[model samples]
Target: MKRELVRNREVGIKSGRSASYYFALWSISAKLVMDFFVPARDLNFFVFNGLLVALFLLLRPRLYLGRRGVALFVVASTFFAALALKDGGNSIIFKIASLPVLVVVFFSIGRGLSEAAVKRLFKILFVEFIVCFLLNYVLSVATGLIRSREFWNFEHANLLGSYVLVMLVPTSYLLYQLSNSKGRIIGFVLVLMAYLSTSTGAFLLSLSVFFKAKNLAFKNIMIILLSIIFVIIAGLALLSIADPMTYDKIAAPFKLINSGGWDRLVGEARNGGGITYLAADQQGSFTWRAYAYLVYGFFIAGETWDRFIFGNGVGGYEIVWGGAMPHNDFILILTDFGFLFFIVWVSFCGWLLVKVWREYPQWFAVVVAFIFRLLCENNIYSYYVASIGCVIFSLIFGAITRASRERGAVRAQASRAVA
Candidate 1:
């Protein structure tokens, strides 16, 4: 009777743990799909903020800032936040609050997640992301809501790119770690999907998946070549679907090469005339982005000392620039947090980069992809990108840290046996 009672207790404990685990996963997964329901350009801030609060209360994870150095960071960030409040003040307090909330949540994931759990989360997320993407595209086309073939049922085209990039980059590292045939196939599909999204930044960053060291080996090289071939075919297929004139315009370069129009091609390249004419919508065009960057850069350079170091205060940029983000993470950080806090942020990211690069190259790739994406998109505050990012990084880093400790202990045992 005692044995049976003990067995029941064990089963109950396991079931409770699983319930908690799945709840955590569901909370994070819900962020990715939540915005799809809302038709506006803005995020679902209410739901996102509520979910974060609920997770914090349920998990109650301790915030471990790791060493005295982080104290300075905390102080700097607090100072900036105060400055923000004193200045113009941001309407969205969650933007500022989400950072520390994500930090605490990272500890929660780190404590509970194993390698298998991380992989399971990735698989669930990947499947859902792909399915939703297809549905969004189909629905957009059928409903005649298309904007330059890039926009979909999601928020924006760039956001769509960001979504896929988030999934593709991390999974690239995961696939590299596994090196299974099926995993490689999935990786290729992700690459193609990124290409189809037409978010140039996301597609470019997603290529980091193929940067695995051993992929240069002959067998892996063949796989990459095949993937490239498929990418070309897919691009052509998409253009053809857009209608005949558009298809011919896209394929004109190849036809020009066949006709040996080298002079014409050279002249067009020199003048930046040919493909530049085929740019996306006005907002997605390179000129618009370059102008935005210049304006932000000039503002940062010309700001007063106090404003530069302490920032114009929370929603200062939005107020000054007609409610548009800086669109660059570094600029957003520098402008919002000031130079002092920006230094701390850079230092923290640099430390993580070096740590992961030395100990875990797979995670390193994902981190690089993330940093690269930040160059074009300021998504650190968003629930979809930042929240999901915290879960992934925490799980991978935690599992690897435990594995490293286990390996060190095993080595010590072997050495003692030899003695």
Candidate 2:
């Protein structure tokens, strides 16, 4: 009896040690996923490679090689093959291929997380968001004399704002799942951080869409909207007090709006073609973007019948004026590849949307938060955007997939018991 008890104690100790090892790997992998926005070269490279090694060590084919997961893999493999076949030596193929691998890594890691583990991940991300926000605010305050947008060494203020906004989707969702008070408080804090970056896209979506209102009544809706407008005004007022020049920098992109010059925006674009046409407005910092979006619309309108059907071909984004995106995903995808590829890509996205939504249709607000960004910024073709997009989407898919599997297993177990 003593020998049996000793053996049982040894087994329990081994299990405890194994769990600690598993969690150490999980925490490191999750942190690497969280830090994709920090633009330190060797650090990201090390963390990313370290993540891959950890993933390889922790891989379980049963989790990823299942029916729905395999279906996703097949779709991704097909898209990669298609991109490779059409690569005209432009670097789109590399970006295209790397996305799914990143998604798979996150998915593999996230799939194994228990509820407690998932909550711990959220707290880590919550801390990360606050830290980055403080860093960006400090740097912007310190460097106010030099730069228009302070990115805290990421890609761009707007892009980083978008990243933070994306992080808020899962952050808010996870917190909401835990408790409403926690969700509302943290959600507001995050939105305030995003607004400080002056990313109109993030501001619009994160506040107007993701954050919750008290009720569904029209009065509540109006109050929430008015409250948001008030907070924005108040926030900018505070920013102006801290640094008027920084406020000016934040407000420059909207000088057209104050002047009621949106009508003038279209005339600027139709002035000529290409980058020169967009850059015609010497007085306007943002008129060029307005000009470019209009130009892309015209270019799409002028596509040859065959080109319109198939896209300009893969890597065909080079033909874009100076090869920069119109800061629109639909325009970027449709123009580079063609209507068909764009449709396929969009349809697959729609499927994920439906799958995710079916799990909880209320989650559509979180999904639309990023969709709003897609309308106003460079889409997943960007490295930062791709990394942020993959981590969030894969986490949702992984979590949902795990729940689905557990339900199936429970049902199977019941069936076996009945038999």
Candidate 3:
């Protein structure tokens, strides 16, 4: 028994140390790559998921598969039934094949994280943003590689901008919690940088942060001002629509709302034909991507109402969507798997968010960043997104579990003393 206790202590120490190192590395590396350079497609996907797989292997045994596992099994069984009834590659068989691997990775990492590690990870992330932003500015001037809007065009700039906004949330929260005035100022500056980037999603996320801040009266005033500004912009846009030629040279800042301006932009693209045109043609300016996935999900749910009650098998979206993965993570599960999987997935996320909010209300800022990104990008199912999500989840859950265990121990001791 003594030997076993000693071994357990050693294991615990090792786990804590390893978790801290990995967390720090991930935080820094993610910021650096996203900010300075255009992420390579394959590399981007692989790094995110690869880190998750590594985390899972490092932190093993305390797995929490939740209802997702059971749902996957049911979906697999249904797929097998379908296979027995018919014959083709359309069999549910292919869908079930990927579930085991995903479960193993997600649960393993989820069980590994601790609150202290998460706090440290956030610190590393903050430093990374500052460093990367400065470096990007320098590189742009020296090499002129990233100066033109053309270079940062399309999904790359949009995604990177979203990342900056998302990182700002946790960084800002951490700064507020640090009790250092200088640190808070630095965090505030980072927030300013994110705002100035002018990524539409980032701008919206910043607005979310402003509203969620501790001062309710101030938030209300800000909201009123924002509404007035929007109204003014709308009126200008209406005028522009009525007199396209007169407004053409006026260059309205609210060009997004002007159909005439939009037509001109689209026409220019059709006549000139480049990446900008392709981007403009994308439905609803990329927001439509989520709706597309949602529509796809409804179609799947309609077809597999019975089979998907549990799930259509885990990771089934990869097969169902084929080359084009669903742009919405929520829809990915709901449509490809079923209502059961969707409920479980959403419940788990909701629980995590609530817990984070309860313990560290400031972290909600980070959550805003993530949600804004989710609106425009489907990072939830993407390998990197899943990995980061799992790590963050693990850290939050670990903190909650550890705190509960400590409280329980203290209560037990007090009861024994009274006895």
Candidate 4:
């Protein structure tokens, strides 16, 4: 592996110099808005996984995996393929097939993706964000109404939220690294957009960009004042509705908060309550998600031994659950890939988490946000989600590794001069 790394370095195959690298980045970024224009989900699948297949055959980037890594990959892929044969659909099959290609591409990128490349990727995303925001606003004004959850340029509200999250975290981290004041301003715009999109998770995570602001006191005051005003306006709007029963829906979340939190939720699940009480209008999103976790848990527990060990296969969750998905990525993995593959998945993610902690601690918050998104959303099958995330973090790993080596060399030179 070391020899392979050295060989790549000797050949000077920089990521920025490669056309395929840019194509990968562009395809990833383009997927964010492609849904708005095309509205065909399969196109996204093709543009992303198809490109990975092409890259793997053409570029043939080295895997850069250790023995353990290879073992984990082979095991996981075998199970994924097996499950696909048993119960998986084309989406799962293609997604599974793309795993090896993703491995090669991410590994090649993990070797290095230049800062210039990173900047270009985010710049494209930022421009798209601005354009989408403006278009949504103009359309809303012209229509004289905005939906409770605006989809912006995407086909779904949550997809817009996902895109915002993908953009907000890493871009904020990069801006903060440069001590750019402009980040806060841009973050405020994104925060507002998130709120308008009605995605609570994205709205909260977008605030991280302002966490280290120099004028924290002033920002807090302004934020509080704005929030209060927004609440008042929203309350008035609700009150204007002739439906007096709206209060019951408005108070649903408060009821959940006052109820016993985890204990009650788990207890309900154990009692085979299902999600009858946690259904849409009865409770908030958190309570609904809690029920979802328990439902997936019971399903996994009830699986036959063979299915339990190897999983029902990719897309298994929807197939078994009557087209319902486990929105939580961790649960999705357990249910789709089964118990054995989940172990490997956790190990790989743990290794990556440790690497980030050691090499680029500054991006820890961004990683946390990404993890939160994974927990709250179904992302394993989405090509853009995988590409945007892995590419950015790979670049981070490369940047930090190179800088550390350079610093070590400088320290060695200083010590030699002293001697």
Candidate 5:
């Protein structure tokens, strides 16, 4: 009877392990496909996140739960509570509904980061980006759809372009780390294709790669300089042929591009009558609610403090901004939750940045892209934002955890040897 029982336990363990391996693969593949092809859809988040959560719960006994994990839970709870209160109970209820999905995202990232796995995953991503971009472009041109603005309306293309651009720096760095001729050639070709796509974000991302690689080889600098020169020359040629009315139409956007931060802020403040000029002849509401939250938090204390600490909750921004998410993530946190939550959120970002720097410095391009995008888009609370955030956070946490374990093992070995 004892022998039979032991056999049953062993079989259970083996089955569990096998299930986990398949689950991890499924989660990673789903994430990649969603990221590339269906990024704008909420359903992708639901499917991927559901799988991730199931895997985590099933494997929790074997997973490490540490300080960071505890902190994450606390932060999530505060945000969840804030959402509930802000939305008149609906926000909280929705967050509860979504909790399982968030867990899956967290676990999926954690499970996918073995060193060999990281390299393999990146290689596949690089290939996919190339193939997808080519196919999209070819289809667009062959169908005579390339000239239509509707061709650019596919949100997935924009998202993928942004992803490639944001990842270019890190991808290049990975190539350098691999230090193989084939890796370098493939990386270069991928970057070249990304640039040819003329996705503004991707082009900017390529600049990041140039700066990162410039010190190692003058060739990077030369390529960047040539690209800039070519763009300028092309612009001049177009301008020379453009009608005066066309030139006039384009000049307003140019003025906005040239307006510095302080000038824009001052203009917004002076024109506070529910409208401000974003560019010449282009006007919209320019309320600086984010600035208001920061200043208010500094002045208020107590349950005003709870509001400051926990945030008004998820949809709290709507109360202050008339149904608009705060453009600044920092302000979004302060207004929605409060100062305490804001500080913790910022601290988490700092910790994640350090981890990425230590283990995957090249991936910093994506971080930069996120920051750049945030200047114009309130991405932090969006479904896509949450998915990307959870994945990256899980990856960093896993890397940090593994490093700590390895260090402890090394120290233990040395101590025993000395004894």
Candidate 6:
């Protein structure tokens, strides 16, 4: 593993070279709005990210095609195969648009960074991004350039808030490991402020998930979470009773991410549906919404043999939804490429999850948090999300490789002793 680490340096792979590192840096720089600052499919995304992927692969070509890698290949090939059988410009366009994210997947497979190395990289990005957020907030206030519901350059406040988890989960976990209680508290607060700035349901949900990590005990976390929930409910109840108008104003921010929080509770409809959300909102849960939408879309796409099995290919969801973006990765993926692609990708993701749990049980919580976000968001289609996934998977894969190398070293020592 040390030899691999040295080789990484020989190939110019630094902490700054990681795709996940750039996901944080580029997102922070997004306010500049220049093509150079953009992290999407821009030249910079191509040049630097591509260079990073290239160097890592150059050092360890063997890491390029593990079981997970093969699964992704099968998925990508299925997409192209779907495109070939279908007739539409959108299918071609979708394929082209997805290529950059595919490259991100390559980066993950190319660099099998050990668990410690991955944690270190994540911590560095966490501190740097939080510092930038503080400085940017101050500067934006001074200049009065900050727009309402906008944090940094994210057009959607939820994206900014939830994205902070990419840093927060790892930083908190690291602090817990290092026994730096004060540092952990400060990092949690800073990250929480960034998260609450948007008050997005998904971001809040991610925070709740973070509590279950190894850093915190189950009983303590349950007590803390239950107490918070109780307070929020009591406050809303009192506000509603005391001043309806003031209550509306106070709950306005909360309602932005969700249409109705407490109001729905007070209404008679609460007991009617087991799921409390709008049928359209999937009860403000991406998993529920995606499941509901996909069932409907499958029928809409038709039960024809080929269509049912292979789907209408990429962009077929528009035919089902009248051109609205699916806004759910599962539904969008399943409807576009059908059962084959969806199954392969999900299986690969499941394998990665198991590997993470097996290798670094401490990080299982962090993995769960991000998986929830991925389920709720169209991260599968987002390049930034792809980069985040790539970096995370690399850690587990790297750790696996490290373990294998250690076993081999022990065997070599035994053989030499026998001589």
Strongest candidate by TM-score: 2
Write one digit per residue (lDDT tens) for candidate 1, span 77-132: 57646654575334444455555555555554544444555566667777877787
* lDDT for residue 178 in candidate 2, whole number 0-100: 62
Please give the range of 10 consecutive residues that has the lowest summed lDDT in model 1: 278-287
Q: Which regions in candidate 4 have their CA more than 4 angstroms from the true location?
A: 1-25, 49-79, 110-112, 132-155, 211-254, 257-282, 319-321, 409-419
* lDDT of every model, 2 decimals: 0.63, 0.63, 0.51, 0.63, 0.52, 0.53
Give candidate 2 regions above 4 Å deviation.
1-50, 58-62, 136-146, 208-267, 271-290, 313-315, 352-357, 404-419
TM-score of 4: 0.71
TM-score winner, 3 or 4 = 4
- Model 4, span 81-117: residue lDDT tens: 6656665445656555555546545655545444555
Reference-based lDDT, residue 327, model 5: 50
What lDDT tens digits, residue by residue, belong to model 5 across residues 155-269?
4333444445534533664665576777567666756765555444354455555334213236865775797789756764675486333333334344444555445544443
Error of 2 at 32 (Å): 5.2
lDDT of 5 at 377: 38
Ranking by lDDT: 2, 1, 4, 6, 5, 3
Task: Give the higher-lDDT candidate: 1 or 3.
Answer: 1
Steric clashes per prediction: 1, 3, 2, 0, 17, 1
Off by over 4 Å in 6: 1-45, 48-50, 53-116, 132-148, 186-190, 193-199, 208-305, 352-359, 395-419
Clashing pairs in 3: 48-384, 312-337
lDDT of 3 by residue, 1-419 (tens): 99996677456544554443464355437625653565564454456456545654664335545587668656655654654344344533332333345444333433444445445656766677677766665655576645553223224444445555655545554655566776556556665665445344554455444333443356765885697589657844874787443343233323443434454444443333322332332323342343344446455745745866755554555555444555566766665557876787677668857765666554555664575466455554333334444344444444445556667899999999999
Per-residue lDDT for 1-419 in model 2, tens only? Answer: 99996676446334432232254345444544445436564466456656656656664322355687678887887877777777737565655677777677667655655455555656766676677667656766786711666555655666767777766655755655767777777777877877777675676577643455324457866886798789889978997798665566456547655666656666655654433422223333245566678878777888799988877765566675667667777778798768887888788768767755566555656776666677677755656556657766676556566667878899999999999
